[model samples]
Target chain A: MSAEAERDAPAGVDGAAPADPWRRGRWPVVTILSVLLVATVAVSFAVGVTAYPPGTIVEVLLAHLTGRPSTVARVDDVTIWLVRMPRIVAAVLVGGALAAAGAAYQALFRNPMVSPDLLGASGGAGVGAALGILLSWGSAGVQLSAFALGLAAVLVTYTVGTLVGRGTESTLTLVLTGIVVSSLCSALISLTKYVADPDDKLPQITFWLLGGLETVTVRGLLPLLVPVLVGLVPLMVLRWRLNVLAFGDEEAASLGVNPRVVKAFVIVGATLMTAASVSAAGMVGWVGLVVPHAARMLVGPDARRAVPVSALLGAIFLLVVDDLVRTVLTTEVPLGILTALVGAPFFLFLLARGRRAWT
Target chain B: MGSIRVRIALATAGAVTAVLVAGCGQAPGSAPEAPESSSAATRVVTDVTGAQVTVPATITRIADAWPAHNEVVQMLGAGDAITATVLIEKTAPWLYVVDPALREAQTVFTNSTANTERLAQARPDVLFTDKSTQIAAKTTELGIPTVQLGFQNYPDLKKMVSTTADVLGPAAQQQAVAYNAYLDDTLGQVRGRTASLPADRRPSVLHVYSLNPLVVDGTGSIIDEWITAAGGRNAAQVTGNVRPVSAEQVAQWNPDVVILASSAFVAADTGAQTLDKLRADPFWSQLPAVRDNRAVINPTGGWHWDRYGIESALQLRWAGKTLHPELFGDVDMLAETRSFYDRFLHHPLTEAEARTMLAAQDPQ
Candidate 1:
């Protein structure tokens, strides 16, 4: 590591760091986004399994919400409330959680590419889901096992990470531990997959590995949503502290921020969000990795602007991808495949042209 | 920074709008109106997924996403129409001789994913598959009509044959009707002979699908259906199509009849002990089925009876004959099997060939 360069001492002691990069237009963007998120979700309910008209979907959803009896066709009501509604809700929750957590990790690790799964939540959840399939436990068991183990994997990583370092190297050490744990979980998943029955169990395992929101149900979403909200609330509250955390620990403390305590809270929040997202919808990669980059590109490096926008952007991106998935073919393509296909090109484009937004 | 951020957001908005338009442009357009009658040159069959898919009323050229469905189509007498197939040579090499026309059919798929472009070049009137979402999607994208074949049980297999026969048009209808009648007659013979047996008199059968992990066929599986038809209760009490249990659990089940139904490759790759390979192991001789000399290998022709294939109806006979040899003592299985090939499959088997086809013992 290079020694710290001598810097010009603050001339006025508090000159606000040269007006901070083009004054992020956060709320205007967010307020517009909040409306977009609602509209996108409302639109998603009309177009899955079978397409219903928008007016009919709106009527059915409103009726279901108000406890007013639905007069729409049985298929329309069932499609909207029973299947598509829960699925879109899952997409929103998972998408929002991944983006929010991704922003947190990018801030905490001070690495732009740090995804929510940097801590091995996806890997652990995969192994758990595979084990559930092997045991012939039903879908509930699979989701529960995945959720439980995903949280466990990260907690173990965090606990193990703190052991290897006391102060200066803690954050980097934690990332290293996460990579190691994720690799371990991935290897275990491979082992389980190897022994699984190729005819039946293997296909189920392969499907889960590919990751999707196609299997989301109302029952499955309830348990996942609570933890995801709980995880996200803390991150949204601590998002401002992310800017302080971005300056290495010594600098953070000098500026009256306890880096370790704040880092722990942020990691826990991110972990919870990631674990919940993964447990709800298997291993959907790239959303956490790339959505934040796009968000950061749009709103500079300030966590207060970027994190919430990341959440909104992630939700919109997933909704559109989900739309493409349901409509593109007769069957649901794994969202992971679509995201990677979409994310990689967008990433290169961001690198090529959006470098200024990162400042 | 401000200007670039606006461009980034605008670019994103533009891309999203482009995708939405392109995506909506392909919204299944309008589902093809299914023809009213089979005589209308296109017959609409509601597939297992409950989607009404139109198939050619006169199926002259066919292709399947997987070779497993090739055997089913062949049995339904539509094998002549197959212009392309997947892995038929390596998998069921017998198909090349049985249906010499298969030699000319292109290999359009080997594993799960089909080469959609090559498949389209094959110019099949209809695509046959045993139901796959990926295949279904690809066929729809390529505007190829597809028929999804499914067999829930022995009874469902009959229905599948009849349905496929109807789809294949008039020429195959005779074979479908004849096969259905044969199915009824064969099962009727088994039921007539075994219907009088008390519940306790019927043997407890265990279908060992794999031996290392000790995976067994449970309820909802085709093996379970065959066992039930053959007049034995499945010993492994479980739910789902199949379940992987322990050797310890196998011992506890104390199955009177253990039928092995795994291949050498599966056994080797999974490091699972096949019934044939377990002769030297200490645990092999300890089981109740082994003690009674009731351990037997499942018969395979084209493919195993357990898999959804044409040989499944014959599997019923084999299961019944093996379980209760006393009742079916007069039925010459070898001669009857040869006749089945000669009459239904249109390929007569010599004595040596029939014996090879009937062989269940591990050559290993």
Candidate 2:
């Protein structure tokens, strides 16, 4: 772990002892992750329930993108461009959002174990989605309800924590309130499930709760793209500041940064990304928690490098998982199950190999 | 906890002794002078959960706790005997046509959950329900006997009808026989015509039961039974009674016909979403069934055709006609609906009413 970090630490070491490996940052790692992510997404197109010839799929893709008429059948063209495109795009968007949020959260909270829903967003969104399904709101309506409710839940927790805290101790209060709100959201979800109609509503809630990217449509993606981009752009803009804030409030203050405001901005950005992703594709577990930590191992703890790397890794990882889910199983296996099955082992591997990275 | 356990044991012993004493003097159909005397000629019978319950021998009144179970009981000519039931008007409009007086029957359930206080107040001789620990605990703690039953397919329906007849006694016995006979006759008639046909010749049928999650009735579902009987191949080979399936699966199967059994709720309210929405989805629209407009809505009577109930025969006949029109050419589905209601429930239906009951329409 130390060998790579030391080797990757370029010029300006500024000490007789050495440089802090955590600041051994960016460029090279980002370039590699970018190449890998694009390759993984392109490969995902060939895998599905219906088999398509890879040669034909590539030709159709080139023709469609370049605005040239394809000899490919209309059905195959529609399947590749219309059907697979929305799902593939959704996978990238949801995966990237969750991982970025998770990275921002791990940085802001100074805890690697913390997930994207360091606040109550995912749990709260679950309650919203369940209620929407119970109300027969249809697919798009449920997504909107989930997005609205998730943001509302976090705002409530943030408000309560700020209103009731002793100055800088609000961070402590916010974490505690997030825990309380998450528990409350879970209870409300259970209540909603219990009250739901047995035949139609109950199964929808149960299946939806397990999570999938099966229903991602182009129309649904338009509204979702706004909130997700709105969330992500700020995180990208504030990446260097996020790195500064990671060194503790006193250190951040010494470096001419307001710890409270930076923390707030990061939290809002991360929470928005999380709520948007969860609303789009039910509660997909592990991507947010694990991806950032893996990215940190490669690029050091600089948010500038780690956050984008996490987004790329998360997008590629989820595309692979979703591909395996739809193709490998006879019935569409729930996305949550595959992530944990695959993530837990990889996380254990990361823990062993990157133990020094954390310390 | 100790006191509660002792009280339960004591109550059970007392009830057992009381039932033994009264049951010795009673026969199956002889009514007690008072229905709620606690020892009103109790007869011991084992419920589906394997719990022995001491119900009154002449059960003039019963609380049909699970409304789906009402189909079996109603078909057993015990519709008038159900003193308490779940919501009837919406879930089972057929029950109203069969027995108008049941409109005033005590609503025993709050949605699917039993209102135990209201149920106790109503004082039915036995409670007809599916086996659950809560209900079993309640029945044991209180001295009310409960019978558990479920209907999954036509064969299971016949068994439930027979069991309901046994529970309801001799007067309802004929209806159980009629139900068994009707089920056999319907399937038999469909099979006799369909049996000789080669597998390749049969239409491949897709039975979509839910829309939001896009679930299909796979193998072991009642819809599968109807499809095979109706001389059609079941498109979905997935296991389990009902399973959430992908659009790709339906597209891959590419059934000759698509039959949707949605909530009359979705059909009536989401007019925009009626199979048309499915037909609009890029993946779903590509399905051969959707593309050719070979989709038809399942005619819901009593409960949905996919939902376990008494209307299997009607659903089967409907599927048969849809799948094999030439073979079932003489079969008038609307006329069959009228005849089934008239013969079984003894309720004459107008042609408009029959059409309304079936809710079957070819895709626009």
The segments of candidate 1 whose C-alpha lies over 4 angstroms from its true place after superposition are A1-104, A108-114, A118-205, A211-245, A248-359, B1-13, B16-23, B26-40, B84-88, B100-123, B133-138, B264-276, B360-364
Which regions of candidate 2 deviate over 4 angstroms? A1-19, A23-27, A50-55, A62-68, A167-169, B1-364
Give the per-residue lDDT of model 2 (tens digit) for B185-276: 98899999999999799989888777667777777667778889889988987864557788777778889998877552255644235767
Clashing pairs in 1: none
- Residue B100, model 1: lDDT of 73
Clash-forming residue pairs, model 2: none
- Model 2 residue B311 CA deviation in Å: 4.7
Give TM-scores of the second chain, every candidate: 0.84, 0.82
Q: Report, for candidate 2, the interface RMSD.
A: 32.4
Report the number of the highest-TM-score candidate. 1
Candidate 1 per-residue lDDT over residues B148-185, each given as its tens digit: 76665677777777767777877778888888898889
